[model samples]
Target: MSETTPVSELNEAEARAELARLAAQLQRANRLYHAEDAPELSDADYDALKRRNADIESLFPALKRPDSPSDQVGARAADGFSKVSHAVRMMSLGNGFDDDDIADFDRSIRKYLGLSSDAPLSYTAEPKIDGLSLSLRYEKGRLVQAATRGDGEVGENVTANARTVGDIPHDIENAPDIFEVRGEVYMSHADFDDLNARQVASGGKTFANPRNAAAGSLRQLDASITASRPLRFFAYAWGELSAPIAATQMEAIDRLRAFGFQTNDLTRLCPSLSDMLAHYRDIEAQRSTLGYDIDGVVYKVNDLALQARLGFRSTTPRWAIAHKFPAELAWTRLEGIDIQVGRTGALSPVARLHPVTVGGVVVSNATLHNEDYIAGRDAKGGAIRGGKDIRVGDWVQVYRAGDVIPKVADVDLSKRPKDSVPYAFPTKCPECGSDAIREDGDAVRRCTGGLICPAQAVEKLKHFVSRKAFDIEGLGAKQIEMFHGDPVLPINTPADIFTLQNRDASNLARLKNRDGWGETSASNLFAAIDEKRAIELGRLLFALGIRHVGEVGARDLALHYLDWDAMAQAIDAARPAALAQRKADAAEEAERQAAASDNRRARVKEARDAAIANSDVPPAAASAWSDLIGIDGIGTTLGLSLSDAFANPDERRAFDDLRQHLTIVSPDAPASDSPVAGKTVVFTGTLEKMTRAEAKARAEALGAKVSGSVSQKTDLLVAGPGAGSKAKKAADLGIETLDEDSWLQLIGDA
Candidate 1:
């Protein structure tokens, strides 16, 4: 849950944990999308999450999870009809989040091909259709079979539905004996609106978006239902083919067009990197007028030979990348600013704005992010949006980062009201009247009224039962809010939830007679709560909602410690040890910083050891602290957060009390048979055979734990050209060292 932690700051442990979190979240998101034909997460949020996952993988390739998000495609085809096993896999493209990602992509392509920067290269850029993927097969100019991409290798048969799509060619002239055309089945904005209006008139469930509408229409159980919807197909790619259609990407599109398949007219051929970027900008600028949803532009190496050489990753093609756009922007009047406290007590600022149409959606609220954001500064007080502060009655530009959550991108001082006053942020908790404090090195001001703050308590309760946590069916945000303020059955902490039914036993008549409550519903609620009494360790940890101890952190701790008592005992034992270490470290730092003393290193070590010797902290306690933080993915940041939570009397009482009612199940042991599975490895310098990331990934897949720096625990060091101080340290520590070739040989180059 390093949501705010920079990619560069992440260690292997944090990156791995975050990757696991992303895998589970993204998988659920994909299921909501493909299986349900609805988008639960916004496109922008999905891409952002994907980019975060990809970035972490690039940094810590070795820590990539077995269920890595990068390797995942869309959800498997929903169970219905017959499944079609694709002759060739239908792959996704790698994503380029920003201009820098594009640049890196280009660099990576060049490096992979061993070409110079100025080498001859050309690409084809096309609008990446936001729609359902379908593959159509033809035999001797006659349509034969059609299918939807089901998990990449398999798909659902949709030949009957494909015949009804107006844009699909029933028969093609002068075609190969066997040609498979692949493209996206989509609904235009006008068609989607018309369809929704018709559905409304007919009293049917309207689609969420054009993509959903198209997907639902195309995947109908009845072909007659598909024919009624105005669905369009854009054939941008081909699956299996009887013969080679063209030698280049642009030529292939042209061939597909000539074969009567509807192709995107906006597709273009670019001969250089600059052309690719310029075309992307051009497409983005004209996005709204396209009359169809397009998340981004796809760029592919035009040369067919180069593409063949490029091959593919586990899920994506190395030769192609999608350059996604940020959310659309529009001008809106900033009417007001509101502060809302989160479950963790961090106050967030939100803006109330005059409703404005942005990217076909009506937006009235924008995230101010924080107090610093409202004041036009970053975490370091650096200028943002040219240091322009936001105020009430000011005209501002609003945009959705993921086409869902709106944010104020910039302010227009020219339209500011003359009498506008500078707004001052609240210094106290708005809900509980407690002093809100911002600690040093922290960006957010948090409420000090932990249990007393109604906002925090309610939100925390909601989180405890959220889909990612305990997942109690009857307890949702609405229920949490009602129960938090209820006079007869008030829920104030995690413990309250478990003891709710018992507390209400004598008052069952009162509960059953209440508004929105009946005897049956009340019994069901209690049953739901009782069913979760025996919970997994990870779910319990995440349900507690301790700061920085998110889903990934909780899972990692659960995997390492196995049970609640083990983790709690370690947390308890680590506090004094951590304090003693902190004190000793401070004393040594002070000694070292004193004016250039002779034998500075010796004196610093002596000062540290002496401080540790004088302190009452036990060696066993120190070992416990080390072990707690040493768990893979458990770093100093999370370790300290755990200590702080346990150290606080209120959090400890709540956590312990909640545990009293639940049976915590130990996590299953993870067994890996890789040679390096238990060994710690440090990779340094330049790798010739593969990029540093790829090398790390390779080593990690074989069971090695990659570290950023050389340390005492390092069992091996993989060094290449320009091996630096890390290599020297490895040699000094007598750790085994391997060259690129030897390392590859050891792993059998798998």
Candidate 2:
């Protein structure tokens, strides 16, 4: 199946087939990128494939193979080098992309430590070098061995190659008798360019980038080849220290420098988050000028004691985070524009661009946002960048940062062709030719075709079987597409998926005999479908893919309504309530318009009046609307989306038809016998013994309502070390609070 195939369309057979394909593909990629240092795929493409594999596995948990790529990290150590197991593992750091993410990281740390926001917490910020990691072991103040960080637990021994590097000190003074300094092995940009120039002159292979050059140089089987290449090392951390080097991370870095090791010059100890971010910006500003390449900045808790207390997660340190710079930008020609219809019928425009490298990843497409963006106007209709509209032939800047979708940043007006014309935004559904409407306050224009729109119907069906929705085993995007496209064995809707076995059995030829399907696999698929006949109410609601009803929304609705029948009824009742409110608003607008004395006010009043009239909701429907909006986390937008989906005759009929083929089970009520049963509980900070998800799941199992924030209604607050504002709020509200250990005791898990 193509990567663009929706996850919902894949049947069990297709999912299994895809899983096997992903496994083989990722394994080869890992070997090429990690072992051979010759990656064929871009990091973005590789990540996308991995994410797709994970999503499929989530949707079909039973089909998760023993050799699943998600469970592996990097390729096994190349056979050329002797493997040296690490005494203290050199772990990677998790990433923080934006200011909010950095703030959340700090808040999370404070919460985990049970510290107030204003408490004295400091962090050491340093450039995160874009190079290979290395560990240098020293005994009796003399370098004994060096190794590359191959797979965390064990690494390839590069002692000979490391010894050739000028930055690596053969001996140290005033250092711990035994120490293992963990740092990066890198080639400076100048040195990399020089080396590449020399290689090209000598008719040898040229390196792609500095990082690859450094990695290739270090991994050379011939030590003399590494010796010829200019390599440098920067010691930032240590593993298996014989004695304490310093009390804080910054002090230790200084100690490392004193011991004849180089450290990043820009490394600074920031007293607070503001200082840290300022330092980060400063480093980012100086990044290009710096001889060595750096992708981002790493921040770690300054206090050694605090770092110890924070400890480590499975693959990364809890006390440290890498705040990456914004994605690199590149000017590329906008080839064309394509409109993609979502499950909700929202038409999103995509800018097809000439292939260009941005931050080492190839970019061929970027999101145009909406019609306003295409017309060189902001969402509010204000001119953007002097109202320079992006034309088909115009050169546009595209950017991709962290996990964000690639987006068009700006259009180069100078590069726009004289013949370029303003792109027309479609007003009709491309799939069904129905009117595509732009609702007031909505940036997107959506099709009113509902299920009749092939794009909308296909997308909705895909969403229904997605990982976060019904997650039916053996039913994935490819299978859905295949079955939906088939005239003789069509699976057009969620209900149709359930009727597949019956339809296949009635056919002259069995599905088992079809190309890519065997008797056993077909039987397994049927069994998988049968297994999902009874599903959770939340999953059922989420599967519907109502415009604004996301996973959390579905859960909130399920928690509030308890039963599918109740939720359906509430949504049905909300329609009239919403209609009634609209009518009441229209009447008020009419009075305001009549009393308006000026043209501007009259115009404003007229718009309001028009909006109210068009809404056509009766005031009597207010109660249902109120009930829906009253649900925690359910806002007016989401409430209306739910009501509208239920109110639509076509959608309601589809849902009714689907419900008949399945059993919807309500979640069990919170346990009443337990001490915290039926009480609202809020968890803050990082839990020590278990993850926050695990804690929440356990709490819900015992009948407690786990809320995201603390309030007066909260009976208890389970605070971890970095409990920060939530703990303070709980204290101020007079709600009882317990530390991780105390909460564990209360839960009888201590």
- Return the top candidate by TM-score: 2
> What is the C-alpha RMSD, rounded to one decimal, of candidate 1?
10.7
What would the TM-score be for candidate 1 when compared with the true structure?
Answer: 0.62
TM-score for every candidate vs. truth? Answer: 0.62, 0.71
Give a tens-digit lDDT track for model 1, residues 1-750: 325344443444466577778788899898878777877877877875776687766544445677777777787888886899989899887777568788898899887776769989888999999999999999998998999887788888999999999989989998778999999999999999999999999999998899999998888999999999999999999888888999999999999999998999999999889999999999999999999999999999999988887788889999999888876679989999888887778987788888887766576776787888888999877899999999999999986554234668899999999999877888899989989987544678899777778888776776677667887877766677777878888888988888888874666676789889899988888899899999889878887888888776787688667778878888888888877766786777667755245655677788889988988988778778877776555676678778878887887888889888999998653356766675777778777777665666566566566666666777888898989998998889899999888888877883
- Count of backbone collisions within predicted model 2: 35
User: Worst 10-residue stretch by lDDT in candidate 2?
Assistant: 1-10
